[model samples]
Target chain A: MMRTPFEVPMDGLPDRVTIYEVGPRDGLQNESAIVPAGVKAEFLARLAEAGLTTIEATSFVHPKWVPQLADAEELLTRMERVPGVRYPVLVPNERGLDRALDHGVTDIAIFGSATETFARRNLNRSVDGSIEMFTPVVARALENGLDVRAYLSMCFGDPWEGPVPVEQVVRHGRRLLDLGCSQLSLGDTIGVGTPGHVTALLAAFAEAGVGPERLAVHFHDTYGQALANTLSALRAGVTVVDASTGGIGGCPFAKSATGNLATEDLVWMLSGLGVETGVDLESLVATSVWLAGELGRPSPSRVVQALAAESPGRRNVTQVPAEVPPAVEEE
Target chain B: MMRTPFEVPMDGLPDRVTIYEVGPRDGLQNESAIVPAGVKAEFLARLAEAGLTTIEATSFVHPKWVPQLADAEELLTRMERVPGVRYPVLVPNERGLDRALDHGVTDIAIFGSATETFARRNLNRSVDGSIEMFTPVVARALENGLDVRAYLSMCFGDPWEGPVPVEQVVRHGRRLLDLGCSQLSLGDTIGVGTPGHVTALLAAFAEAGVGPERLAVHFHDTYGQALANTLSALRAGVTVVDASTGGIGGCPFAKSATGNLATEDLVWMLSGLGVETGVDLESLVATSVWLAGELGRPSPSRVVQALAAESPGRRNVTQVPAEVPPAVEEE
Candidate 1:
């Protein structure tokens, strides 16, 4: 029997990668129907059970802005905190950070856009103004003994600004890191990025002394280049990848944006590359299938769709509820 | 105004690539409805006009097997052969090659599988048996002064054989190449490939004295790794990429297999990377959208979907057919 079918790594590839699962928060943020708080908690728990160490649970953005994740505090409170797993929530401002801290959140993320047009349209501030706003929010979170992650959106292309310069993105990313954010996730919100753009951006970041350890890649599948761009980042030594289960999430900024890189798809690639992501492929697929049912739509993920079609009864997350019923003694 | 929004190529990446369009033949072969011969010819003409130098027009396979492409000879006969464009068709055996020769076909392709299961199911023979069957087909095609391309399917994963060995695939690939094939397209029929797998396979092939110049990559987007795998192959110096317009063509052998890498999506990535493919993105998207409407379904190509959503009337292929009508004078 072949013990390792695709368990051999090629030269210059990472031995292991960290998949920062963002399905619970970013994936559902743009959803039309607000998911129940308990359901959100259950989804996060399943993701953690599938061996994902970091799962972005929910966002603390105002209900008017992101009604889908309005029950952030309630979801976090009801969630079982898996040991050794980190649940990061999106914090837009100091007020959101304070709310997250009140819920005992250890990890929080702030977002800014690399392009002025996106920052102005999405966050109601200029690019520099958005950075200034996030500066204090990140500093306060770090001071409160929480790990901060800064997401620099529109890192690749801006719907209004067109192609963003590599140097500009690196500058904003470095600023966030300097402001005490533990990690900086460069986002392709419009999904117009190619592998060459990713390679060039990562190389520029390395030249600016921002190592891969401090960088994560968050890509959208609008142009279907997410996985390819992720590969470019991986080859450039960036270990952290942000993906959505069931390939959920449309960018609130870019209306044409599709879903993020599907977690199942990402896991498939990593497993094939012999890169350890500590993710259970079967379990992850189940979670996506379950989530797809909850969302009342078919998943946009090719892996989820393919696997579901393979086994008719595979999406059994609904069959087994989040809470088990007490054994009935009937004879 | 930005002179080149996405015209910068990265270091160590291919500056140019050859996109072998496979929509008319491979793409439509799996369709349930048979496209009209005129439509097929129009599609081929539009593909050539959109700057594709090589288009797989039709397959000479028996009509009983692929009813969708049954009008292969008629489509070829009615097609206006563009200058500097090579139109190749699939020839299953000596009979098929003879039929192609009767139509004055200049280039032909023969397909075999690297795995025995796919070989038996697809060709009704073992891997060796299938290769032996194709040896004469390829030799005959070469004897007729035709360029022969051998497609080796299931090079990455087999539905029955979990993960094919890299060395074993290389051996099969070498056999096809040694059989006087001008080019060999390694197919991931099940779409279970990663960048590492692609890199490793290409490297192994190089070791076996088969360089990337003699190879083309035919990937399916089942797990959303098609573009990534193509990127890896491109980085490894394999410049020929096989893609289907509108992301058409599900493998008949693998039920779970999705469409091949969409030519529009591939062109988007290659264009963004500043890799010249000579394909006009707008015109190709229009072709996909028009064909999608003709097929009574939405296109699976992300670029086509995104661009169509952005422009309501961008799919003007219906407005102006490939053979434009002479401008009517005022009556």
Candidate 2:
């Protein structure tokens, strides 16, 4: 029997997608090798050149806790700031916020996982305990005129508990949003989430008044469902997506985590759908390729290599072969 | 406010999802080191032992074209011949068929791309031209009492021809199925596909008279949508899914292409959902880890390392930590 090609119905999609680059913090945190601050700054500069409006530059968490970002202050101090790019660093408490404010981080992301176990394990405190620790930080950041974005990790699934409870995700999201988070990004930490799971979770969040306008969907490409799940979220009206250039980072806590969905891959999907993301696919690829060499292996972003390979010597935005049915087998 | 845990309506899922393991052919093809015939045979043997009833063992395409499978005949001859396991080899032409039959392969997969540019660049023919070529090959194999599976590449998107039209894909799928293909697998060659694309294509295929039972969904994780797309297809009643273990393969025709969906990742999703695939997750991880060592890189399947790392010395299936979210970046 003959099957016709799929017709994508883009009836309601966000006009412009905000790509929050998390390469510096989320990306480097999971890597076992300690990247030098100079190299990390170089990487951040390249990402900014790729037209990323917001990059999760660094985390102000205790250096002893996250050894990867021990040079956080130095990295922030040395970066060649992109004029319009908002570099949001994660600050866990008053001390962390103090560091970011001192370093002139105008926008800050105050993050917390949904589950008690993750909060306890990752932040070394229970969910409420971490939030209590965060309240003053949020108040101070807001008082200091900083824009705060709360990350609710394990929004979809947990490592200890199979599937995440929606109520928990929404509850966590509400706290962050109520605390003037401006935006709440729901994360599927382990990448075990499916579209249905995403739909249900987000719908629940919406029902409780967390509309898509103030929501961003952060996904891991663990199960190869990141894009599909992202598509579902897009149709459901998510405007902001957190991604990494060259898909650099992972969740240090998740055992088999891959990097965030490659920004190149995300931009490719968005640009292909005619959805506006303000990201140049070609520059993103060039940036990823450069990072790949620095990382000493091929990048996790399959699109970067495929597009670069196909258009050898051609400019970045050459006629893209439509719809390369994703063949990547990354777990 | 505590959010309740999210859960999918698993009761309605289909029983016994089809496992189309392409590791033997697709997996080995991308390896830079040439795996000896005995090693390839050993690989296939291990695959069958993992209870994979359907394995695309080897391709009889010219050795000059794909040097990795130069020993296709020798490898097939030494397969373990596990009962109920359908070992299909790629037969591009009549000569290839003779070789596969010589090795006593009862099932064979004959593949061709949908777009003219790809057909010409990949198989050296037009869409119509390749179909004409495959007809005789399909006929010969059917006459030899062999089951035939037609592989339609670039069904959703073409590498050269941007977005492939539904009308064109349908025409190709109909022709191949008409020529006696018992099963047809639609591929997103460059891994640049979405669920809307998959759902639309599969729905069109079903509308064209092909039932879910007669089709397989082949996706790449290029955009990290392969597994999520697979789930959408499964929801639409399609069962067969082609995945590679440890994500150890890439499209020869596509550049910077990543590995296929790690079989371990696919199986983990399936197992979590209670779908009976009949493959052991721990053993799959072990095999992927061992193979990764042989290949001198980490396995693409993050599940293997995550699970292995958590347990360290034992293959444990303990549920992920309830507190921390499942590792998002790893997958």
Candidate 3:
């Protein structure tokens, strides 16, 4: 009943990948139930214990806009920050950046939009206006010796606008990178992309002089294309992938909709591919199970469900040997 | 609101793929509710109408073993046989083959196992015994001018035996093909495979002289690796994939466990990759929506859910043009 996949390496992929865990901020943002700051702090600690080096802790957006993380300051003050683990908080504007700086946050992320409709709806500004708005925020963060990661949302397709063009996404991505951001995370907000689209987008970014080393991919599982697109991104030389533990952003049990790609599912693939992710699959599954109990529903993650179903006694079973003895022949 | 994905062709993949729709057989087999023969027949007809050229009609296993598909003969007799569409039935042994022949089945499949544990548990025989048993069945079917397909289950991982060796799967696959099976489908029953494992297994088969033309992949989504694995298989030159409409075998609304890779999900990715599947996404999603209502649950497919939520008028809104005019810019 061992849940680990057999290691089989493929060519043209990085030997190791950085899994950017986004459960606390992106995942909990979509939940209808409000979690206590103490519980959120515990979740962050558990994520660090599960070997995630870069966990997006919480967003500093106004309480009126994102009430889920309204207690962000309380949670950050209470949470035990692991030494080597980086907890990056999302800063929406100068006000959010001020709050993040006040909290002594060293790592921050700014959310941008590739589509005009999303930019207007989410940020109340045009795409160009939003970029102009983030200019000072990113510059100030860099000036203060903080790392800034910019998220370009709707890079693949938009719910309001369909089939985003490759060149337009590249242009916006390059603009965000030029804003003194350390890295740009491409967001397929609607999860409508395929492998080819992913490859083409990365190629465009490369053509624009934004190498894969400075790019991360944040894919949703709304259409179940997240992992396949991730595979394509890896083959195209990208090394950072974003995932949410338990796929918590959208409720899988209700109406069969999913949000972020589950961290456990992503880790399972990375583990089977012999890619070093520095994650303990067992510990991650355990954390998801414990969190699911707190959420009052089963986890949306397939790996969490599969592994949690096994008896606790079998959880620590020895891994299957690479070469097993042949079965007895019967003619 | 168009459900279609924008075509973005990827390199190293076939321009066209044959999807072996298994909804009528493998999909309903695991459901606790028993669908009527007439309903199964209608389902097959709808699948054909949705542009699936190859549909697995039903299985002739004993009713005692699979009461769900007990009406296989009735289904075959009642179902409309579309011209140029292949309706393959599962014939477990000579008895099953006799039933299929009685119904004038021209395409038939035999299920085998790569692991000794599954062979014994499922077929009451060892791996060798099962192959020996299939030898005459395949031979008889071929002699009758029926196209024979062999299913090698547990090719990736076995629940009881754990990760199966690639060589073992290739050997059994070769034996099945040698018995006159036109195609051998490798099944990841527990869905523990990754892209690397998929590539390695296909490479092993190619080294054994069985090219991708003679191979199909049947992947479950238990651990959510099915789509990613399918991507790898396609990259390795596989053009046939097995999927179930609505992902009906396992209920996603119940405990978040998924069985087969949903046809809608597969078609979404394939369509996005510019691979022709001949399936109209709208018609397919509508069919799945109707079937889900009949089954008294929502579909596990993300595509189905997303599209079904759209207003009826929006479903047919002219597809977003390949090149959209840029949005009005405001600085």
Interface RMSD of each: 18.0, 10.3, 8.5
TM-score (chain B) of candidate 1? 0.90
DockQ of each: 0.18, 0.21, 0.32
List model 3 lDDT by residue over B214-260, tens digit each.
99999888888999999999999999999999887773223356788
Cα-based RMSD of the predictions, in order?
10.4, 6.5, 4.9
lDDT of 1: 0.78
lDDT of 3 at B259: 82
lDDT of 2 by residue, B206-263 (tens): 7888788888888776555576567767777877899988778754444445657778
Taken over the whole model, the C-alpha lDDT of each candidate is: 0.78, 0.72, 0.84
Model 1: clashing residue pairs?
A: none
Q: lDDT: which candidate is best?
A: 3
Superposed model 3: Cα runs more than 4 Å off: A251-255, A314-331, B251-255, B315-331
Ranking by DockQ: 3, 2, 1
Per-residue lDDT over A151-227 for candidate 2, one digit per residue giving the tens place of the 0 to 100 score:
88888777566577788788887988888788898887767776667777778988998889999988877555577
Worst 10 residues of 1 chain A by lDDT: A320-329
